[model samples]
Target: MIKVLIADDQEMIRSSLEIILSCEDDLDVKGVAKNGVEVLEFLEREPIDIILMDIRMPVMDGVLCTKKVKKRWPQTKVIILTTFDDDDFVFSALQYGASGYLLKAGDLDTLHHAIQTVYSGGAMINPGIARKVVDLFSQRQNTPIIQVEEESVNSLSELEWDVVYEIGHGFSNKEIAKNLYLSEGTVRNYLSRILSKLHLRDRTQVAIWAVENGYIGRRS
Candidate 1:
């Protein structure tokens, strides 16, 4: 089961999440916290696989809390929960190692899937925020171009290279699978090997590297 902790200041929100998440057989609500401080305290006492962190709270905010949690427990995945599509908060949370960013207005199915995706070493971004992320990265200036050697390119098999190319294009596992006539599990496995071979962290890094290195076409 995927163990989760919900952290939000609003009592109703917390209760609603608890109820919604409890219906999923694969998920378990480990605990609930009112704010970042309480989240930290809960972590001290429980074994949690994921955290549903709110952006704004009384004491420490989600971005700061996410940084601290990642520092202390790098294995624990965090999914930022919010009511707004604040670009600053989204970017800050991502920079702080949040595995996912989700709007609270998202349906229960989406929320459940986000938890599963993040727990499986993948990422989830609210569809609304995902467009913003793409635009933000696309608009950034002064990004240094990377020149990868032919030897590095030759190291990857054709299939692995295909996976890398798609990731560079910002396609998720499901999308890549659909495009390539492969299963999502197969795409994920290929991605795991791609990251290992490329010495990259997540798909975001892969996208940046791909663009800078010209591993994939710029306009795809």
Candidate 2:
């Protein structure tokens, strides 16, 4: 089972999420926290597989909390859930290692699938935010351009390269699988090997690297 923690300041959201997620056979609600501080406390006692985190909170915000969680407990993945689509929050959450970002206005089913995707080592970005991420990432002039050698480039198979290109376009593994005519499990395996061979972290890094390396074309 994929153990999950709900961290939000609002009791209503926390209770609702607990009820919704606890009903799933493959998902378990490990704990609930009112704020980032509580989230840290919970992690001190036990390990969790994923965190359904709210972007805005009282003591410590989700972005900072996400950074802490990823730094101290790299195994734990975070999915940012929020009512707002503020660009700052979007960029910060992804930058801090959030595995997924979704608007709370979306259906519960989308949220559930996002959890599963992230738990399985893929990413989920809301459609609206996906475009924003591409635009925002393109606007950044700070990160240096590092041209990968042909040797490193040739290390990945054509399927793996296709996965990288899809990831660059912010396509989730599920979507990539459908488009590439491969099973979702196969796409997940390809992604894992891609990350290892490329020496990158998560799909977010893959997305950024794809943008930088000119791998993402207009089709992407």
Candidate 3:
């Protein structure tokens, strides 16, 4: 089962999400927190696979919390589930390594799918949020690449390049494995090595790097 933590400032939202998500057999609503501070405290006590975080909170907001979570627990995935979809919120949260960004208006099914997708090593963005992300990153496509990063790109094997291309398109490990005719484990191994080579923190950054570096449109 996918272990989860719900972090929202409101008591009703926290309780409602806990109830709704608990019905799923694959999901385990491990705990709930009133704010990021409590979320961190709970995490310190136990391991959680995912965190459904709200953008705004009392002591610590979701965006800063996301950055801290990623830095402290890289394996723990975070999905921003909130009513706010402002451009700054969308951009900063993802830039700080949130695996997914979704609106609270979406159904439980969408939330569940996002959890599974990010857990399985893919990134998700709400369609409206995705457009803003694309436009934002597209602006940086013309930015110059330094020699070191260019050399790092050159160091990747053809198979690794295939994985990068798939990641750019937001394919999960399962999808990338099927598309490349490789095993899922092999795809994961490729991904790990790619991250090490490129000095990227996670798949989210890889996707952004792919788009900014022109991997999306050129895919064959």
| Residue 42 of model 2, lDDT score | 98
lDDT per residue, candidate 3, 127-172, as tens digits?
7766666777777555522112778888888888889898877778
Q: Note the residue pairs that clash in candidate 2.
A: none
Q: Write the per-residue lDDT of candidate 2 for residues 111-180, one digit (tens) a residue.
A: 9999998998778888787767667767774662333556777798877888888998778878899999
User: What is the C-alpha local distance difference test score of candidate 1?
Assistant: 0.79
Stronger candidate by TM-score (1 vs 2) = 2
Q: In candidate 3, which residue ranges exceed 4 Å CA deviation?
A: 140-148
As a TM-score, model 1 comes out at 0.81
Residue 53 in model 3: lDDT:
95
TM-scores of all predicted structures = 0.81, 0.85, 0.87
Provide the lowest-lDDT 10-residue window in model 1: 140-149
Those runs of model 2 whose alpha carbons end farther than 4 Å from true positions after fitting are 143-158, 183-186, 212-214, 218-220
Every candidate's lDDT: 0.79, 0.85, 0.85
Model 2: lDDT to the true structure? 0.85
Better of 1 and 3 by lDDT: 3
Better of 1 and 3 by TM-score: 3
